[model samples]
Target: MKTEIIWMIIGMGAVTYIPRMLPFVLFRGKELPIFLQGVLKNVPFATLGALIFPGILLIQEDIWYGILGAGAAFLTAYLGANVIVVVLSSIAVLTLYSYFV
Candidate 1:
Protein backbone atom coordinates (compact mmCIF):
# COMPACT_ATOMS: atom_id res chain seq x y z
CA MET A 1 0.00 0.00 0.00
CA LYS A 2 2.92 2.34 0.55
CA THR A 3 4.38 4.34 -2.34
CA GLU A 4 7.82 2.75 -2.01
CA ILE A 5 6.40 -0.76 -1.99
CA ILE A 6 4.32 0.01 -5.12
CA TRP A 7 7.34 1.32 -6.98
CA MET A 8 9.42 -1.67 -5.89
CA ILE A 9 6.82 -4.10 -7.16
CA ILE A 10 6.58 -2.29 -10.51
CA GLY A 11 10.37 -2.30 -10.84
CA MET A 12 10.57 -6.01 -10.03
CA GLY A 13 7.85 -6.80 -12.55
CA ALA A 14 9.68 -4.92 -15.28
CA VAL A 15 12.96 -6.63 -14.41
CA THR A 16 11.44 -10.07 -14.74
CA TYR A 17 9.19 -9.28 -17.69
CA ILE A 18 11.89 -7.74 -19.90
CA PRO A 19 14.02 -10.87 -20.06
CA ARG A 20 11.03 -13.07 -20.91
CA MET A 21 9.87 -10.66 -23.60
CA LEU A 22 13.35 -10.29 -25.09
CA PRO A 23 13.50 -13.87 -26.40
CA PHE A 24 10.22 -13.57 -28.24
CA VAL A 25 11.04 -10.14 -29.59
CA LEU A 26 14.52 -11.05 -30.73
CA PHE A 27 13.65 -14.47 -32.14
CA ARG A 28 10.43 -13.54 -33.84
CA GLY A 29 10.41 -14.61 -37.50
CA LYS A 30 13.82 -16.22 -37.09
CA GLU A 31 14.18 -19.95 -37.32
CA LEU A 32 16.42 -21.57 -34.74
CA PRO A 33 18.48 -24.54 -35.86
CA ILE A 34 16.92 -27.92 -35.13
CA PHE A 35 19.57 -28.92 -32.58
CA LEU A 36 19.27 -25.60 -30.73
CA GLN A 37 15.51 -25.87 -30.69
CA GLY A 38 15.71 -29.37 -29.28
CA VAL A 39 18.05 -28.25 -26.54
CA LEU A 40 15.84 -25.31 -25.66
CA LYS A 41 12.83 -27.61 -25.42
CA ASN A 42 14.56 -29.61 -22.67
CA VAL A 43 15.58 -26.59 -20.64
CA PRO A 44 12.57 -26.65 -18.35
CA PHE A 45 13.12 -30.29 -17.42
CA ALA A 46 16.79 -29.69 -16.77
CA THR A 47 15.96 -26.68 -14.59
CA LEU A 48 13.36 -28.62 -12.63
CA GLY A 49 15.81 -31.45 -12.03
CA ALA A 50 18.46 -29.04 -10.86
CA LEU A 51 16.05 -27.46 -8.42
CA ILE A 52 14.55 -30.68 -7.08
CA PHE A 53 17.55 -32.99 -7.02
CA PRO A 54 19.21 -31.17 -4.15
CA GLY A 55 16.12 -31.26 -1.98
CA ILE A 56 15.73 -34.96 -2.72
CA LEU A 57 19.28 -35.63 -1.69
CA LEU A 58 19.18 -33.47 1.43
CA ILE A 59 15.97 -34.64 3.07
CA GLN A 60 17.10 -35.21 6.68
CA GLU A 61 14.17 -36.80 8.45
CA ASP A 62 14.41 -39.97 6.40
CA ILE A 63 16.47 -40.51 3.26
CA TRP A 64 14.08 -43.17 1.97
CA TYR A 65 11.32 -40.61 1.98
CA GLY A 66 13.17 -38.55 -0.59
CA ILE A 67 14.33 -41.57 -2.54
CA LEU A 68 10.87 -43.05 -2.82
CA GLY A 69 9.36 -39.74 -3.84
CA ALA A 70 12.02 -39.21 -6.47
CA GLY A 71 11.61 -42.74 -7.72
CA ALA A 72 7.86 -42.30 -8.11
CA ALA A 73 8.33 -39.00 -9.90
CA PHE A 74 10.97 -40.46 -12.17
CA LEU A 75 8.84 -43.45 -13.08
CA THR A 76 5.85 -41.27 -13.82
CA ALA A 77 7.95 -38.92 -15.91
CA TYR A 78 9.59 -41.83 -17.73
CA LEU A 79 6.13 -43.08 -18.68
CA GLY A 80 5.54 -39.71 -20.35
CA ALA A 81 3.12 -38.26 -17.84
CA ASN A 82 2.62 -34.50 -17.81
CA VAL A 83 4.76 -32.53 -15.32
CA ILE A 84 1.80 -31.93 -13.04
CA VAL A 85 0.98 -35.62 -13.03
CA VAL A 86 4.56 -36.49 -12.26
CA VAL A 87 4.50 -34.20 -9.23
CA LEU A 88 1.12 -35.38 -8.06
CA SER A 89 2.08 -39.03 -8.45
CA SER A 90 5.13 -38.46 -6.33
CA ILE A 91 3.00 -36.80 -3.65
CA ALA A 92 0.48 -39.62 -3.81
CA VAL A 93 3.16 -42.26 -3.42
CA LEU A 94 4.75 -40.43 -0.52
CA THR A 95 1.43 -39.94 1.19
CA LEU A 96 0.79 -43.67 1.03
CA TYR A 97 4.28 -44.43 2.29
CA SER A 98 3.74 -42.18 5.27
CA TYR A 99 0.34 -43.60 6.00
CA PHE A 100 1.42 -47.20 5.88
CA VAL A 101 4.78 -46.87 7.56
Candidate 2:
Protein backbone atom coordinates (compact mmCIF):
# COMPACT_ATOMS: atom_id res chain seq x y z
CA MET A 1 0.00 0.00 0.00
CA LYS A 2 2.86 2.39 0.80
CA THR A 3 5.01 3.89 -1.96
CA GLU A 4 8.30 2.81 -0.34
CA ILE A 5 7.08 -0.80 0.08
CA ILE A 6 5.95 -0.92 -3.56
CA TRP A 7 9.30 0.36 -4.79
CA MET A 8 11.21 -2.07 -2.57
CA ILE A 9 9.21 -5.02 -3.87
CA ILE A 10 9.82 -3.98 -7.47
CA GLY A 11 13.53 -3.51 -6.83
CA MET A 12 13.86 -6.85 -5.08
CA GLY A 13 12.03 -8.61 -7.91
CA ALA A 14 14.25 -6.98 -10.55
CA VAL A 15 17.42 -7.95 -8.70
CA THR A 16 16.38 -11.63 -8.61
CA TYR A 17 14.84 -11.69 -12.09
CA ILE A 18 17.73 -10.05 -13.93
CA PRO A 19 20.31 -12.72 -13.09
CA ARG A 20 17.94 -15.54 -14.12
CA MET A 21 17.01 -13.82 -17.38
CA LEU A 22 20.50 -12.58 -18.21
CA PRO A 23 21.87 -16.04 -19.02
CA PHE A 24 19.06 -16.83 -21.46
CA VAL A 25 19.24 -13.45 -23.14
CA LEU A 26 23.02 -13.58 -23.44
CA PHE A 27 23.10 -17.16 -24.74
CA ARG A 28 20.03 -17.19 -26.92
CA GLY A 29 21.93 -17.75 -30.15
CA LYS A 30 24.70 -19.91 -28.76
CA GLU A 31 24.76 -23.69 -28.47
CA LEU A 32 26.18 -25.06 -25.28
CA PRO A 33 28.43 -28.11 -25.48
CA ILE A 34 26.83 -31.46 -24.69
CA PHE A 35 28.69 -31.91 -21.40
CA LEU A 36 27.83 -28.40 -20.27
CA GLN A 37 24.18 -28.94 -21.19
CA GLY A 38 24.10 -32.17 -19.23
CA VAL A 39 25.56 -30.47 -16.17
CA LEU A 40 23.09 -27.61 -16.42
CA LYS A 41 20.19 -30.04 -16.64
CA ASN A 42 21.12 -31.50 -13.23
CA VAL A 43 21.52 -28.13 -11.52
CA PRO A 44 17.98 -27.93 -10.21
CA PHE A 45 18.11 -31.38 -8.62
CA ALA A 46 21.49 -30.62 -7.04
CA THR A 47 20.26 -27.35 -5.62
CA LEU A 48 17.11 -28.97 -4.28
CA GLY A 49 19.14 -31.70 -2.61
CA ALA A 50 21.48 -29.18 -1.05
CA LEU A 51 18.58 -27.27 0.44
CA ILE A 52 16.63 -30.30 1.63
CA PHE A 53 19.49 -32.38 3.02
CA PRO A 54 20.08 -30.06 5.96
CA GLY A 55 16.46 -30.11 7.13
CA ILE A 56 16.41 -33.86 6.78
CA LEU A 57 18.87 -34.18 9.64
CA LEU A 58 17.09 -31.88 12.05
CA ILE A 59 14.19 -34.17 12.93
CA GLN A 60 13.56 -34.81 16.63
CA GLU A 61 12.67 -38.09 18.42
CA ASP A 62 14.09 -40.49 15.86
CA ILE A 63 16.63 -40.18 13.08
CA TRP A 64 15.10 -43.12 11.25
CA TYR A 65 11.99 -41.06 10.58
CA GLY A 66 14.03 -38.49 8.73
CA ILE A 67 15.87 -41.20 6.83
CA LEU A 68 12.62 -42.82 5.77
CA GLY A 69 11.26 -39.52 4.52
CA ALA A 70 14.46 -38.85 2.59
CA GLY A 71 14.32 -42.32 1.03
CA ALA A 72 10.68 -41.88 -0.04
CA ALA A 73 11.35 -38.46 -1.52
CA PHE A 74 14.38 -39.72 -3.39
CA LEU A 75 12.53 -42.75 -4.71
CA THR A 76 9.57 -40.65 -5.91
CA ALA A 77 11.79 -38.08 -7.57
CA TYR A 78 13.89 -40.76 -9.21
CA LEU A 79 10.67 -42.25 -10.56
CA GLY A 80 9.99 -38.97 -12.44
CA ALA A 81 7.41 -37.58 -10.08
CA ASN A 82 6.84 -33.84 -10.07
CA VAL A 83 8.55 -31.82 -7.35
CA ILE A 84 5.26 -31.36 -5.53
CA VAL A 85 4.59 -35.06 -5.59
CA VAL A 86 8.08 -35.78 -4.26
CA VAL A 87 7.51 -33.41 -1.35
CA LEU A 88 4.05 -34.73 -0.59
CA SER A 89 5.20 -38.33 -0.67
CA SER A 90 7.91 -37.49 1.80
CA ILE A 91 5.37 -35.85 4.06
CA ALA A 92 2.97 -38.75 3.78
CA VAL A 93 5.62 -41.28 4.67
CA LEU A 94 6.80 -39.30 7.68
CA THR A 95 3.27 -38.73 8.92
CA LEU A 96 2.47 -42.40 8.78
CA TYR A 97 5.67 -43.26 10.54
CA SER A 98 4.90 -40.80 13.28
CA TYR A 99 1.39 -42.14 13.69
CA PHE A 100 2.65 -45.67 14.09
CA VAL A 101 5.37 -44.80 16.57
Candidate 3:
Protein backbone atom coordinates (compact mmCIF):
# COMPACT_ATOMS: atom_id res chain seq x y z
CA MET A 1 0.00 0.00 0.00
CA LYS A 2 2.81 2.40 0.81
CA THR A 3 4.58 1.47 -2.41
CA GLU A 4 1.43 2.08 -4.41
CA ILE A 5 1.01 5.53 -2.86
CA ILE A 6 4.64 6.37 -3.60
CA TRP A 7 4.27 5.27 -7.20
CA MET A 8 1.05 7.28 -7.56
CA ILE A 9 2.76 10.43 -6.27
CA ILE A 10 5.69 9.93 -8.64
CA GLY A 11 3.35 9.40 -11.56
CA MET A 12 1.37 12.51 -10.74
CA GLY A 13 4.55 14.56 -10.46
CA ALA A 14 5.78 13.42 -13.85
CA VAL A 15 2.40 14.05 -15.46
CA THR A 16 2.44 17.65 -14.19
CA TYR A 17 6.16 18.21 -14.89
CA ILE A 18 6.01 17.08 -18.50
CA PRO A 19 3.47 19.66 -19.67
CA ARG A 20 5.35 22.48 -17.89
CA MET A 21 8.77 21.34 -19.13
CA LEU A 22 7.67 20.87 -22.72
CA PRO A 23 6.79 24.54 -23.22
CA PHE A 24 10.16 25.75 -21.98
CA VAL A 25 12.06 23.13 -24.00
CA LEU A 26 10.10 23.64 -27.20
CA PHE A 27 10.08 27.46 -27.03
CA ARG A 28 13.63 28.03 -25.79
CA GLY A 29 14.85 29.98 -28.81
CA LYS A 30 11.59 31.29 -30.24
CA GLU A 31 9.35 34.23 -29.48
CA LEU A 32 5.59 33.94 -29.54
CA PRO A 33 3.67 36.24 -31.90
CA ILE A 34 2.44 39.57 -30.53
CA PHE A 35 -1.22 38.53 -30.70
CA LEU A 36 -0.48 35.28 -28.94
CA GLN A 37 1.42 37.11 -26.22
CA GLY A 38 -1.50 39.46 -25.61
CA VAL A 39 -3.92 36.57 -25.44
CA LEU A 40 -1.69 34.64 -23.06
CA LYS A 41 -1.42 37.67 -20.78
CA ASN A 42 -5.19 37.81 -20.43
CA VAL A 43 -5.61 34.08 -19.78
CA PRO A 44 -5.41 34.38 -15.98
CA PHE A 45 -8.11 37.07 -15.82
CA ALA A 46 -10.39 35.14 -18.16
CA THR A 47 -9.85 31.97 -16.18
CA LEU A 48 -10.60 33.77 -12.89
CA GLY A 49 -13.89 35.10 -14.27
CA ALA A 50 -14.82 31.68 -15.65
CA LEU A 51 -14.22 30.09 -12.27
CA ILE A 52 -16.14 32.75 -10.34
CA PHE A 53 -19.16 33.25 -12.62
CA PRO A 54 -20.90 30.02 -11.72
CA GLY A 55 -20.57 30.59 -7.98
CA ILE A 56 -22.19 34.00 -8.39
CA LEU A 57 -25.29 32.43 -9.93
CA LEU A 58 -25.47 29.57 -7.43
CA ILE A 59 -25.80 31.53 -4.17
CA GLN A 60 -28.46 29.64 -2.19
CA GLU A 61 -29.84 31.85 0.60
CA ASP A 62 -30.12 34.98 -1.45
CA ILE A 63 -29.05 35.57 -5.06
CA TRP A 64 -28.55 39.28 -4.29
CA TYR A 65 -25.59 38.43 -2.09
CA GLY A 66 -23.65 37.08 -5.00
CA ILE A 67 -24.82 39.73 -7.42
CA LEU A 68 -23.85 42.58 -5.08
CA GLY A 69 -20.50 41.07 -4.30
CA ALA A 70 -19.74 40.47 -7.96
CA GLY A 71 -20.75 44.01 -8.80
CA ALA A 72 -18.40 45.43 -6.17
CA ALA A 73 -15.55 43.28 -7.46
CA PHE A 74 -16.23 44.30 -11.03
CA LEU A 75 -16.35 47.99 -10.20
CA THR A 76 -13.10 47.86 -8.26
CA ALA A 77 -11.36 45.89 -11.01
CA TYR A 78 -12.69 48.17 -13.71
CA LEU A 79 -11.12 51.12 -11.94
CA GLY A 80 -7.64 49.53 -12.38
CA ALA A 81 -7.39 48.15 -8.85
CA ASN A 82 -5.24 45.04 -8.45
CA VAL A 83 -6.49 41.58 -7.57
CA ILE A 84 -6.20 42.03 -3.82
CA VAL A 85 -8.19 45.25 -3.91
CA VAL A 86 -10.82 43.69 -6.13
CA VAL A 87 -11.28 40.79 -3.74
CA LEU A 88 -11.21 42.98 -0.64
CA SER A 89 -13.77 45.34 -2.08
CA SER A 90 -16.07 42.46 -2.80
CA ILE A 91 -15.67 41.10 0.71
CA ALA A 92 -16.35 44.52 2.22
CA VAL A 93 -19.52 44.91 0.20
CA LEU A 94 -20.76 41.50 1.27
CA THR A 95 -19.89 42.13 4.89
CA LEU A 96 -21.84 45.33 4.98
CA TYR A 97 -24.76 43.72 3.20
CA SER A 98 -24.81 40.85 5.64
CA TYR A 99 -24.62 43.21 8.61
CA PHE A 100 -27.61 45.25 7.50
CA VAL A 101 -29.82 42.36 6.40
Best by TM-score: 1
Candidates sorted by TM-score, best first: 1, 2, 3
TM-score for each of the candidates: 0.66, 0.62, 0.61
TM-score of 2: 0.62
**Highest-lDDT candidate:** 1
How many clashes show up per model?
A: 0, 0, 0
Task: Flag the better candidate by TM-score, 2 or 3.
Answer: 2
RMSD (Å) per prediction: 3.3, 3.6, 3.5
lDDT of each: 0.89, 0.88, 0.88
- Candidate 2 accuracy as lDDT: 0.88
Model 3: weakest 10-residue lDDT segment is 23-32
As for candidate 3, its clashing pairs are none
Taking the tens digit of each residue's C-alpha lDDT, what string does model 1 give over 3-39?
A: 9999999999999999989998899633899888888
**lDDT digits (tens) for residues 15-86 of candidate 3:** 999998997788853389888888888999999889998888577568899889888988999999999999
**Residue 46, candidate 2: C-alpha displacement in angstroms:** 3.7
